[model samples]
Target chain A: MSLISVGEIQAAAQRIRPYVLCTPLIPAPWGDRDRPLFLKPEGLQSVGAFKVRGAFNAIGRLDAATRARGVVAYSSGNHAQAVACAAARFGIVAHIVMPRETPQVKIEATRAHGAEVVLCEPGRREAVAAEVVERTGGVLIPPFDHPDVIAGQGTIGLEIAEDLPEVASVIVPVSGGGLASGIGTAIRALAPAATVFGAEPELAADTAASLAAGHRVDWSIEDRNRTIADGLRSQPSALTFAHLRQVLDGVITVSENEIRDAVREIALRANLVAEPSGAVALAAYRRGATPPGPTVVIVSGGNVELGMLAQILTG
Target chain B: MSLISVGEIQAAAQRIRPYVLCTPLIPAPWGDRDRPLFLKPEGLQSVGAFKVRGAFNAIGRLDAATRARGVVAYSSGNHAQAVACAAARFGIVAHIVMPRETPQVKIEATRAHGAEVVLCEPGRREAVAAEVVERTGGVLIPPFDHPDVIAGQGTIGLEIAEDLPEVASVIVPVSGGGLASGIGTAIRALAPAATVFGAEPELAADTAASLAAGHRVDWSIEDRNRTIADGLRSQPSALTFAHLRQVLDGVITVSENEIRDAVREIALRANLVAEPSGAVALAAYRRGATPPGPTVVIVSGGNVELGMLAQILTG
Candidate 1:
């Protein structure tokens, strides 16, 4: 399949304009680091994460008949909340099937967005979601595995190009490779001079493995995915892998300690509340994994647990 | 003492324009509040507080001859950091004498901004600051209560008017009347239809008492200042009192527990970090003390101790 193009990203941007924020990119002070760094603060987006872009884009692209059926998603993370938030804009009913083990804060936050949350046993969330679809005729909106979702995410690249103008490199946290591929597609088409790097915690380096193998690779769902960066452990889907291989310049791996440090630094310096997964790009930047252009790091989300934050910032 | 003139506030906006963020005032969507509350995100300012306005304004309005003499202040909190940061922008040397008990983070942050930090015993900070001035030929730049500082703070009022032309009321956290006077003057001049409200924590109600008494009234600096809202214990100065008398339409006070709740709500809903002092406006709003207006609350700062944030967010 052909990769998403600038025109598709442009169209996606237009569709999602009403639902998402043109989140500001703040320039890191010249003295704080060895090189210039700019943060694309997706943490400020609706539902407080970059997932809003793809969620809205996907929702907007849905046919009129399909939207009448409402939407369901299986996620206990930013994606679930993003879909819930975006669906509310269209007055669509959102049913989010989350794991019972999900934090009370996340569940409450998701429900707070007007979504009906169905908490299920961890191993059977998807089955529960499918059962709901069969019962209620709700359309399943998978996170980061569809052409439309990737196209929607590509719009962020368009914004980065417009804001930074001469950005030499862009770093994104890779969970399912959706964000990276989408942003990579836009950069390759609009800002041809810039390189895109995908960041993943070393403990959950499935994306890197998938890239090296030139196919979708799934590690044991529970094996080696034990990093505190909870948002970056998703296995890459075949559709996203195809696009990632076509657009991404490279992937960078970071350790758990590095992710923790980046989160703490952003909180202390930038006055941000970055979840561990949200800080992987900063982790990569701190570890010298960036390719030395006017750099932009995606601050992906800010749903960090207060308990986790205390442990990190007390140091 | 004369009230801060609208002309002075207008001029201060130009003077501190380069040093501070005209922080965004965006629509607020938290819980189920439908009355269109807007957040004046001063917490995003350079030093993570609106105090930068006064600092920058005070520093910028210095006579060229006086600026060459440098400046000094005694603060163990956000005001100290704001002055240090704003003063550094003009290449002026700022000597901040903070209480020795001040958090090391504040000490390092002030030093990082190129300000010379002098730590002294709590009761002796101001005394030490005066001694430094005698040695270094520096002028004392009080954290608030000076004409230039009030004028500088009024620039925030200018921004509030510009950002929310239709605002019905503006609520501000009161440490000193400097912020209130500046904002009240701007609101009275530009948004003539808008009411100005000064907010204070009940635990440190010196400002409220001063306004009632028609003069500066000192509370127990030791006992009255024990609230988690560390920024609102100061009594208004003659300069701010004059402006307060001319411009402020109302004043409200919230309990210390209410301040903590406000801080947590602002963070979870606005995707913004606001310290206890910054949260007093929201606290007032939640307590039904806000006037019948589309209210804009000035989120004053975001410099909470890591331990404190843990306590606030968790409980």
Candidate 2:
């Protein structure tokens, strides 16, 4: 399979410019002084996640007839809202399949975007989404497996390189690995000297295991679901795994407690809210495992349930 | 007194570009449908407030000898941190006088920036700051009273107009009126059709009352001290009041409950943390008093105590 090109990522950046926010690189003076830190707060994007970039790019690239027929997607949280929101912006119908166990806040937000939400039993979202695509005659926008989606998310890496050309290291949260694949590809093409690291919850460290074993690896759904970072439950597909293998310098697995602490720290210190999944990169960075000069951490999403956030902040 | 000129604001914007973050205008899809809403999150600034703009501009413009002599400032919260951060960047001494009743977090943040913090009685901060300046032979940088500071804060207005040219209304939280004055000047000059409104807590609505009476009016410190918005207690100075009279379209007062609710709403919906004072403009927007159009609300700062933020979120 051909990897996404820098040209495709640049094109996606232009296409999605009107649809998504170019979130600023927030400087963290309180961060590790020797390393220096800048947070690429993709959480500030519309729908409160970087998922909008990929969703909009995928939907926007579709021919008018296909786009008019609508789009389908499956996600535990942020991507569902992204596709729903992107579909709404295009004034097209969207059918979103979400896991029944997904946070109520995510489900409601997807519905709020005027998408038709279909909730299936745990571990059955993809199958349910495939059925929806067949019934509705809509194109399925896979959360991470598609090239357009990867190129769209790659725009973030393009932005970080543009804004902070001297960035020595880049850390990104890895779940299905699309985000890291896209960003790592861009960083490799644009800032080859900069190290790209994937951050994962220890409970869902399939990527770390896969990278070490030199092959794709999958943890049981039961094991992945143990992480509070609900978004990182999915394992990488063959295509994304290939891209990750080529682009990533290393993978850092963080504990559940560290993820929770990073969320609280982001809210208190950076004055930005990050869901547990989104805080994984910061958690990894805090562990001091990466070579840091001027580092950038991708704060990927903030679609967390407020009650859960309050609980985390309290603790 | 001569009001802040747009040219001066432009100069300040250029001068402070290297020091401050150019916060993006965040789109709010869930906001008032008819008017549409965008947030200017100054809370993401390096010092966690818009105060850094003025602080950097003020210090950056000083001659080498004067700057080397050090700087003195009195602020209840955000401005102290801003001055300290800016001074530290310039490798100069910063002596900050804060009220004894100020939040411990603010005091600690100021000290963390390597500034010398002096605690003063509630009403004696100015006098105390003056003494520090006298003793140290340092130049006093009064929070919002000086021209450079006002012009620096006005950079936000320049950014808004550049990003959203059709902005019909702009609201900012009012404390000493420098922010409103500066932004109002920029809006008047650049986006002339845009209405500028000041948002204040009803408990500390000195600007509202003063606007109604056609002159600067003072509310007793005891009365102004009743609001949870510690940053909005200061009244407008003569210079800032003059600018306010010329540039303001109106003033909106929100109750204390409304201020608290807006803070929670910002955190929940916008995925950005805002202190009570920072949320005042948003609170005023939610009151449904402003004319419906494309509205921009400045989220001024996010220096809330984590415990207080947790409590507010729990509500």
Candidate 3:
């Protein structure tokens, strides 16, 4: 499989420039003195996640007529909101298929962006989304499988490289692997000396298992759903797995307790709220998995529910 | 009394470029749709507050010979940490005087920045700081009284104007008024049409009272200390009062409940942790005190105690 080129990511960065924020690489002095750290807080994005980069890029890249027909996506997480928001900004309709068991707040939030939300039974979001695409003649914008989406998320890597040219290591959360793949590709091209690592909850360590086995490995949805980092439940797609194989130096699996501790520490010390999924990179860093040098951690998202955040802060 | 100039602020921005993060103005779509809100999260600073801007500017401006003699500051809050970090960066000694009653976390944070911390009785911090200056022959960097400090804080206003030239209004939390004075001055000069407002807790609304009376009003520290926004207890110094009077379009006071609500809202919706003092600007905006258009609120700091933050989040 061909990898995403630096040029594609640069183009995506340009395309998404007007729509997305250039989140600052905030200094995180609270990290180990030996391994200085900075946080690329994509949670500061308007949609509260890095998903917007891919969503906007994918939607923005569509031909005028196809884009006018709108787009379709399936997710009960940040991707739903990202596509909805991206489509709304482009004045195009978005049909998002979500699980019926999804929280009302999530549904309302997606709807608030003016997306047409289609509810489906659990484990049937893909079939439902396909049906919506068939009915509406809208193109499917998968959460992380497409090249446009991966290239778009890679813009963050470009930013990290540009902001800290001396960055020795980059740690990003792994889910469907689009984020790590995109960021890793950019870093490999631009900051070739920098080592790229993927972090995920040990409860859902499918990527680690796959990388260790030197091939794509599948995990049952029920098994993946065991982690508190809900965003990490999805296994990497073939495209993302290929990119991950090319770009990643290693995969670090953090315990659920470590993820919770990182979330609390990030809030109390760094003054930035991190969802469990977003906090995994910092958790890995805290566990001394990353090398001793200037490191950048992608705080991938912050769409955590308030009650969950409070529980983590106190726990 | 003279106010800080945009030219001075511009210079300070240059001097502190390498030390401080140019925090992005995060778009907070969760705010009122018609009035669009953006949060300038200064809490992302290494010291977790906007104080570093003033601290860095003040210390950076010192003559090489004089600066080599070191610096002294009195605070039990973010200012202490700001000065300590700034001094350490400049490779100069920093003697921070804190009240003996200060939480150990704050003292330890200050000392961790390589500062010599001197603890004194609650009412004697200033006197003790003066004695430190006398003994150490270090220049005193008053938290808000100095022109350089005000100019440094004003850099935030410069950034707001530059990033959002059409900004309709800018609100800042007012304590000793350096932040408001600095930001207001920049907005007044660069975005003259933009109304600059000051937000403060009703429990410590001396700035509002003073503005209403057309003179500086003094509130007893005992009365001012009643609010959870411990940062805003200090009354504005004459220098800052002059700038606030010249630049402010209005002063908005929020109740304690309102301040707490804003903190929770900002954390939950904006994914940025704001201290009660920092949240007051958002609280004031929520009350519909500002004119309609794109509004910018300075989230001045995020140094709230974790217990307090938890209580506010749960409340």
| Counted clashes in each candidate structure | 0, 0, 0
lDDT string for model 2 (B1-315, tens) is 787799999999999999998889998877898889999999999888999999999999999999999999999989999999999999999999999999999999999999999999999999999899889999898899999999999999999999999999999999999999999999999999999999999999999999999988889999999999999999999999999999999999999899989998888788899999999999999988888899999999999998899888877
The CAPRI quality class of candidate 1 comes to acceptable
List, residue by residue over A1-315, the lDDT tens digit for candidate 1: 766778888999999987787776666663135458878778777577889899999889889889978999988688899999888888999999998867677788899889999999866878999999998898888888887888888889999988777888899999888899899988888789888999989989988988898777777757644888877768778788888888888889998889988987777667677888899999998877666668898999988667667678775
On TM-score, the stronger of 1 and 3 is 3
lDDT score of residue B53 within candidate 1: 85
TM-score per candidate: 0.92, 0.99, 0.98
Residue A266 in model 2: lDDT: 95
Which scores better on lDDT, 1 or 2? 2
TM-score of candidate 3 versus the correct structure, residues matched by position: 0.98
1 or 3: which has the higher lDDT? 3
| Candidate 1, position A256, lDDT | 87
DockQ of each: 0.41, 0.83, 0.78
After superposition, candidate 1 runs with Cα above 4 Å error: A30-32, A123-128, B5-11, B31-34, B63-66, B123-127
